[model samples]
Target: MSRRKKTSPAEDVVDLIALLPWYVGVILALAGYLLLHRIAIAPLPSALGPGALGNAMVGTMGRGLATAGQYIVPIFCLAGAAISAWRRHARRSLMDNVARSDGPDILDDMSWREFEILVGEGFRLQGYQVAENFEAGPDDGIDLTLRKNGEKYLVQCKQWRAFKVGVPVVRELYGVMAAEGAAGGFVVTSGRFTPEAEAFASGRNLRLLDGPQLHRLLKQARGSSSAKPAADIRATEQASNAAPQAAKTAAPSCPRCAQPMVRRTARKGVNAGQEFWGCSSYPRCRGTA
Candidate 1:
């Protein structure tokens, strides 16, 4: 058995925070500094009363810890934020590159972590909230947990390049899904699946994505992402154009007649084609705005 490498406390803190969004890490950094700085500068208690010596000792120790932590904690948090940002960018880049590539050969070029990131990003683009398991080893089962429309899904990623992912991996994910109450599961690989693996996934809520299928998924996700900006622009334009109509339709009661106002256009004046509120009692109490 191989022993896990020992990490310093600071490194562990950074790793823990790096699993969160970069903005969360930044918030934690600010909060940690503010709170710790307040404690670091707090005045010591008086030593002239009962148990005052112990109180003074405790205060001194607390202040000492806070003094160091004020700087150290924020530094770790910011470092984690930086790491998160870098990973975010790397994941997007990996998906983009693979989606634009001609074949699945590019998938084999990535590390296991990169493969998992790619899978998570794909699910995220498809409107799922994905939680990547960065702490899991290569063969430790589920690499990602996905949630969408109030249902949970587990994903196992196999970055094996040389051999086909077999029934055992798919079976492991299915068992985990049952035990964890997952709604479904996916087994993604950078290689083909064995016939047994495909057979096992059949007739279940499990989906097995081999290398080519994964490539196609990334491509479709990229297409959908690329279409979003155009759709958003069109929606903004529609909203802007509808503002004048909304103003015209939402007219207050006529001040002169107390009747509902109707939207009318200036027919033959300098404001021709411009809309305004006209009284519903048009030929009698003519009120215009």
Candidate 2:
């Protein structure tokens, strides 16, 4: 899958907004401290005159308050920054957790909400207009629809964890694309795709985004706010294009590991007549097909 660079304004806003509470707390604390210090020392006599002892006491108190502010301000700033950064980090971490969760039975486990976000972010990066959580029909299979440069694209989010996304899913998506008259279709999954699924997608307008592709999308989404140099974009494009067509043409190996040349046939099915490649050591290997 080609990685697209698109910044998420929402995420950036969230990050910046998350710091507000900490900033407010620090300001309030500092103001209260300064106010209390002023009120406590404002009545003190000047120059340590007749009441030299009282003057000295007040002077000491003033010095202590000053010393406290000096120590407290820096500590508060550091604490505030750390807490703000952590809150932002935690939100990202939570999203990551949702993305990486093991789908139940490798077909129905993906958190739909997370998958929608991923698709929306992917389209945004690609400069496409993406509509999230779109409901076409009960069996429509499309979670999102994207439009770019006058071409319509349909998207299906399969948040599977273990089992490879098989040809059936792709076939269903293809049917949806035809019905919708879409220019292309995308099947984005947190899990891997089976060789049959990959093969089915080949020579078709359908594109598959597996786990690694999803990771790349996440990285791009996170990095979009920062502009990438032209040189960097060129280098990435070159690297992507430089990969051997053979490598790209190869069938899905182990979804767990993208090792190609692993094919097999099911013991029984209408597809039992068909051949597929799985991880060399399956069951125990628990690898993709």
Candidate 3:
């Protein structure tokens, strides 16, 4: 059995903290006030009379804490409002494409994060409520879980540029579908699929989308975003931000599907160690340069 890598607790704590919005501070402050009053300030008040005892060390500390807690409310409210506004702004910035139905070839010049956004946008266009699992690691392959018509659907995005996706990948997705009891499943790729993979999906409740089909889906999505021609994509990216080193390298495309090819080495046979560009749609498309 393989050992699972343990997640770092510190990282988990940081992620948890990030999810707690600023509004929570109000409740925390209120709780602090109650605690301070009970511990040091309440005894004197419960005696039902003003007295010199209120000047005691514990009493002073409690009074100070209680006073500080009073300010926490207004401070929390202001901070919460500001944080809420900033969150809305950041969320809107990232989801700018979610409301648009047309755009460029998403896969052509996108990072993995962008690919997930594109997938969610596509499903949203179809009226499905999308739930993303972008943070899932190798242990969890679910990328997008969608719901509509009282049925659940699981989608996996594979922005593979090289080698046609093979049958095993499709099979694994099928297993996930079964485990989730999903009504159906979709395996979307920026390239194509192998023949064996296609054959396995022939009679199943699974939809396999190759690059070209995915392109059309984006174009026809209801909200209709304006499509940016492929050439403009790179230019737009350049104008918007500095391109990364990886982006500078123009990877070769798969001749069969016109999808980007990934470098691979032969693992068996005489060509085993040779590096070459394989069709990202692997077993489905054996197209090679």
What is the lDDT of every predicted structure here?
0.88, 0.66, 0.68
Ranking of predictions according to TM-score: 1, 3, 2
Give residue 139's lDDT in candidate 1 (0 to 100): 33
Off by over 4 Å in 1: 1-6, 136-139, 235-289
Q: Lowest summed-lDDT stretch of 10 residues in model 2?
A: 1-10
TM-score of every model? 0.77, 0.42, 0.49
Most TM-score-accurate candidate: 1
Candidate 2, lDDT over the whole model? 0.66
- Candidate 3: C-alpha lDDT: 0.68
Highest lDDT: give the candidate number. 1
- Model 2 CA deviation exceeding 4 Å by range: 1-110, 134-139, 228-289
Clash pairs for candidate 2: 103-109, 104-109, 262-277, 263-276, 263-277, 264-276, 264-277
**lDDT tens digits by residue: candidate 3, 189-210:** 8788999999999999999998
Question: Which sections of candidate 3 miss by over 4 Å?
Answer: 1-106, 134-136, 222-289
TM-score of 1: 0.77
Q: Compared with the true structure, what per-residue lDDT tens digits does model 1 show for residues 158-197?
A: 8989999999888988998999999999999999999999
The candidate, 2 or 3, that scores higher on TM-score is 3
Per-residue lDDT of 90 in model 2: 52
